[model samples]
Target: MSEGNKNTNTEPWGGFDDNLIQRGGSAVIDMENMDDTSGSSFEDVGEMHQRMKDEEEVTAEAAATEEEGGEDGEFLGMKGIKGQLGRQVADEVWRAGKRQASKAFNLYANIDILRPYFDVEPIQVRNRLIESLIPVRMINFPQKVAGELYGPMMLVFTLVAILLHGMKTSGTVIREGTLMGTAIGTCFGYWLGVSSFIYFLAYLCNAQITMLQMLSLLGYGLFSHCVVLFVTYSVHFHSLFYLLWLVFGGLSTLRMVAVLISRTVGQTPRLILCGTLAALHMLFLLYLHFAYHKIVEGILDTLEGPNVPPIQRVARDLPNAITVLNATGKALAAGADAILTQ
Candidate 1:
């Protein structure tokens, strides 16, 4: 029984050992087959590595492109920003220059021109004057009038007055003849003086003046009595001189009004011309008191003897002088209206 049991145990243990050897041999064969397989060779591993390297390089190139594109976009945005800023700066500069030019131009280059025509308070006067010269551009009337005519016309008028005085004072003519000649010469000198002033004013203002306008301006002296008498005494016109004065005044006023209207209507050139003429007219009126005194004194000294009756000569001369001066003032006033319109 013992031998039989030992044989059975030996048999069972030998079978178990054989099974273990077969399983181990199968695992070794499977491992060797997996190692030498054609489907997973070193060349396949190398191809996989090459693909990963290629993918890495593509990723780096894409990153670089993205970085370059970001830079390009930033550059474009900066350029656009700079261009917009430049335009804004240029516009501001241009506007500043225009404003400066405007501020430099003022009416008559004097504050006294409107004093005779307007009776507004001092504060109002300055305000009105500033209003009249609004937009104060260098091209406005005051600058043109002052620049072109002020000095030259003064010099010319002075020369003419001296000549006229000399012509009558040389004692070559009789007293009556000298008086008449001096009167006529004085009238001519004054007319020439006014004409030159107007012409210079027109030239600077770019006005299209006709010969008729010049004649009308010269003939305006005929109505001087009415203006002075009417304004000074606050009297109404009733006489023939007064009627004549009214007609001339109307004509001059209408002409100036038309100029102002044109300017307001966007006729810029016409407005500038009218403004310049008006400014010069204002300046001329300023000189009238002094110039008239000097010229009249010179004429009287030349015509009437030094011992002649002062009252009689003055009485005779003053009325005519008043007549001319009144007309001149009216004309200047008309010119001012035109400038205001511009």
Candidate 2:
């Protein structure tokens, strides 16, 4: 009882004290390992930031180099050989356009170039006029004599004036504005359009003639129209008008054909060209004759009074059956009005 009792009192807590001491030592070692891991993680983060900064500097240097190289070497957002080629093509197009514009300006703005074509002698004009009137006379005439623009321009203007005067004198119910416009348009349109057509044909036929030459010849040809207009308006005879128109029209056609044929070489070509020209001239003349005659007939009807019988009007050789009906209708209307008033 003495030895066992003494041992129990000395070691009352025994293994529990040993377990507490060992746990405390293990916790301290775990805390030191955590501190070391945290320090290493911080160092890795700093290294990553430095690597990003270096990459950013490299990218900035590349961008600066491209900008400096592009300043003197780019065109329209293109680069290198392609850009240089584009610039050259653009320059060539610009130069070509500039040259064309300059040529057009010189052609239109300079009046002196046209002066030579208009400087014609009165005797020359008279001779050309005579030749245009008589187809036979133009046979031996010099081709150079038909190169004046003044005579043609004057003749066209004169024809217009004469036509207007005839319309006024006829007392026809035509608007002056409309009549003047029509006369000017018909005369000038025929002159320009036909002359251009003939010139094109001549070119096709290999005839060495200029545009101004064709214009001059066609312009002078208007003298026949002036003569026909003057005589028909003065006489007021339907038969006389037709006679003059046929004769003068044939003469003009023959004259034009002769001149055109002289420019050509081959017999078959000349014949074909002359035939075509004759047909064209005759058709043009016929159109003009019909137009003027219609006006003249209107004037005659106005002067003769509304009571003139339809049969008598028909006997006046009205060109259109519709014109006869119009006259008959007008006469009937007048009679009906008279009967109503009475």
Candidates' C-alpha lDDT: 0.40, 0.62
RMSD of each: 35.7, 29.2
Clash counts per candidate, in order, are 6, 0
Which candidate should be chosen as best, given lDDT against the real structure?
2
The stretch of ten residues in a row with the least summed lDDT in candidate 2 is: 13-22
lDDT of 2 by residue, 140-232 (tens): 443553577999999989988887776566433444458888778978898899888878888777765688888887787778778888887
Off by over 4 Å in 1: 1-183, 196-206, 221-226, 229-272, 279-342
Highest TM-score: which candidate? 2
Cα lDDT, model 1, residue 28: 49
TM-score of each: 0.23, 0.56
Estimate the lDDT of model 2.
0.62
Q: For residues 99-218, write the lDDT of model 1, one tens digit per residue.
A: 776666554455466444333355643342233223233323322111122222233344345434433332223345554555456545655665666566555556555433443433
Colliding pairs, model 2: none
